[model samples]
Target: MTATDNSTVRDADALRADMVRALHDQDAITSEPVAAAFAVVPRHRFAPEAPLDLAYDLHSTVPVKKDENGLNLSVMSAAHLQAVMLEQADIKPGMKVLEIGSGGYNAALIQELVGNDGVVTTVDIDRDVVDRARRCLDDAGYGQVKTVLADAEAGVPDDAPYDRIIVTAAAWDIPPSWIKELTGNGRLVVPLTVRGTTRSIAFDRDGEGLISRSYRLARFVPMQGEGAAKERKALLRDGVVVQTDDERVPLNTKALNQALDTPRREFWSGAAYDLPDELELYLTLHLSSAARLHASKEIVDSGFVETSALLGVPALVSEDSIAYRTRRENEDTGGFESGVVAHGPQAEALADEYLKLLRRWAENHRCRGAATIRFLPGPAPSTLPENSVLKRHGIVAVSWH
Candidate 1:
């Protein structure tokens, strides 16, 4: 290993301890095996370009790349977020796990967790990333984890019947091949996007259907290769990409599409920090059946929403999202707070009728300080990374219990 690689390994050891503490603080991880696995796996090794300080920032989202237009391509998810996924997955030794995105550092953690009994097969569309991961894993003596240079959308069918499947990259929908390849009761944890919002959804197969038990707002690089397209290959309306999905519902269609020009003057409408009574009731009835449950973030002026002192909620999104801010401040803010100007689909009057359900979810279920959202697998198996909506463009409510 080079000098930089050696330093990263050392930093990971320290970062692992901090990560454990952060997990405990959030009440996100409870498994000892999983925690130990994360501790041993060197994250910096996989992401060579990331800064040293970021290697251990518990709540940081490591940026992978950005285009000239300022669009982010990929990110290394926060430690707590990944920990939640691993805990939900209940990954065990002797089980075969199919992982998307060949990040050497993350794969190393999986390899350590699976031990010799378990096998990890990672696929990535970028040949360069795949090759880099291969070298990192091999150098770290984790060559046992098989690395494949292929489009993740295709799903590694040759290694079918996997006990667990995890996609590091965010997908629009769960590819049908992945569902087909899963063993009965198998788990599939994918970062899903629905109606322009992205979330990490974890589901388990139950007979003919799949049930989502957990979800989180997450962002990652879009998938590429056989199951993905190279360019937009479409027209844009006012710089926004348009969808061609069949529209059946007409409720507030115009209002949903209409853009607001003037800002509303409402101070802490109880919409940002607290859920309204109406929304609380909705979530109670449909929390279980909620489908395509994804979350998005919006930053508004503090004048509209009341905030605490100078230490306002720097990032004003809900629980199911990654912070859109600098890493240094995100750790201190810990995301949303009591006082801050926040905006979301749930907060909009056009969507508020159904979004209020999210509030009830917080009251009924103990979110471990965060809310639980679910995304169901879509009808089309071919569209692995496309949003799968049940009703409108947004997440639809589904029944769980």
Candidate 2:
């Protein structure tokens, strides 16, 4: 090869090595197989339009496609997240794998894990994405990874009984077909959206339902086609909004906005706050009336809302009152202390309810992976279980042990 070509190859190899090391340090790459896959995959080839540095960045996603309104339709997920999910999958050599969302780089990594004897099939609802992934896989010498253009909601039935199925997009629920298509002992790793928050959960088959082995905080583009989320969003003002998938949660936009006009009330839980992901999972599930509260930087800067709302925090909403979690550094605790901010006439009641949950979590389930999630597919029961979220296809029941 020419000197210029040799230099480019060396640069890509260096970046890949750095990314693997960072992922390992963060505990995202916990297995040798996963580390090897990340080290070998030429991630930059999948997103040729992006800079090489961006392709190898550990925390940033490379956008692949956008919609008419300039929203990302698909993106190459960050390397750290990919490594986390792969480790969660625990794919072994000669294992047949099905990827719900098509991204050439991830599929290539899967190919490396599965080896020559294994089969890899990737499906995407968008034809453009399928075409792009197909070309990228071929260019990267991963043509053995099959590409299919179809809505992943139905799954690729022709290749049923996959040992492992990894979904890249944010799924609202686990469909019946996915469970049926997997082998009896297979594992399905999906970024499932429960209420308004999403978590990447690793589930193993259990009878007609699925049970989680582990879950971690994750964010991804929403799934398209038949299984799209049915969540509702009400814009309270220019850059403030509340979103919820639960039908029981009230979305009184006018009343909520008016409640914001009143003075804000703050309630301190007097409990140590850490392990935010675990805390959030408990709060979102246990809150009687829950939704996600979001505010823009402009509103936060104006002192109308705290920075917690900037990224959408779990909120307790009543007819005319709202309360959400906030944090303050506690010198004694050596970290942060959880608190509540409420508004409207029933602010006291809402804040009391929210504060109770915060303190309960801190007292009982403050550690990571304390909650176990189970997806029971079929018709909903007359009385929904406590800490359960209903979906079109199943009920997501979460319990702390």
Candidate 3:
């Protein structure tokens, strides 16, 4: 219990070292301190039930707990994402860090970054997760790390003024408490979901508002409790789905489903298709009515939908029609060119709208991290700014250069 079970000790060490090397190779671990922390955390110990290969897998998450519906309630986030966030945090020795979700492995890594003088606390709303994390932390020689069983929405008041607050879950909005709890210059790295896409954004306080320093494409389990997302979902038959958080976007499942029966229309933007993440953010924010279209492989294979929706693609949705991004390799461009696929009675109108956005992104803001995301905490203004999403706590405003 003191170190990894001796039986797997050698294997775990070698796996851990290999994992660190792979993180560096992938550019997930940039600084020496984060690399050192990953090098020693004994990740396999936290997920003892998982296979060593899976536990140390760089891009895979080791599931910790799931609900009766088979949805993940908690997971050991992918090591690659963890490293990226830690680097974004830039944790210094003797700095205090509060991890919003409890997972022994991440807390252990944070402990290493903070060193002897720094304090680390992990909180979870579920008692079972807290108890399990406490047990794992103790077994892994991270007893110094504190485990609290409480809803993380309130930001662990007893340990006020954290140097860094890192949320492992995907949040719909930045609560006022999280910003209030940060030290004057403290940073918060959270996976914030906007429109329908989620990005891990590093936010620093700018007066009473929060401005993003950087944002990376990330996927994580949605937060539970007070900060849970209030998304509207529509099932347009067996394998096709559409969802959005913007209350203004209409989701008429029956009408949209019928639109699928109409002949499909395709339009090319004449713009190069690359840096999909950046393009997606721009489209999601700039679209007048944005939603996400998702399709199972079966649907895509049946020639009913494009492969872009297999994971989820930004869609411009109207009352009875939908237009989502698609791409095809073009010899002239030397790569893929952005295009649109529209369905329903308004297919032409929707496709024209979608194509314009695609061309605009390629011409003006088609680069990594081109969008500037800002969160202003307070009541909504009488007239909200353009490209602004309203949340319970604040309005998220995004702009492009």
Q: Give the alpha carbon lDDT tens digit for every residue of 64-122 in model 2.
A: 89999999999999998999999999999999999999989999999999999999999
Clash pairs, candidate 2, are none
Clashes of 2: 0
CA lDDT, every model vs. true structure: 0.55, 0.93, 0.92
Indicate the residue-level lDDT of 206 in model 3: 86
Candidate 2 vs candidate 3: the lDDT winner is 2
Using lDDT, rank the candidates from best to worst.
Answer: 2, 3, 1
Give per-model CA RMSD: 8.9, 1.1, 1.6
In angstroms, how far off is 220's CA in candidate 1? 2.9
In model 2, the Cα lDDT at residue 45 comes to 91
lDDT of 1 at 312: 19
Per-residue lDDT for 1-401 in model 1, tens only? 99986776676777667877778778777888887887677676666677767866777877765557887555666777778778877888889999897667677777777889999998887776787778879877798999998776667888889999998876655556777889998998887654334557787886644667776656567765554422211121232222222232122313322322224312221222332222222332332222111111222232322222122112212222111111112334354312112233333432333333333343454223243344444453443332234522123334322
Tell me the tens digit of each residue's lDDT in model 3 across 58-174.
989988889999999999899999999999998999999999988889999999999999999998988988998998999989999999998888779999899999999999988
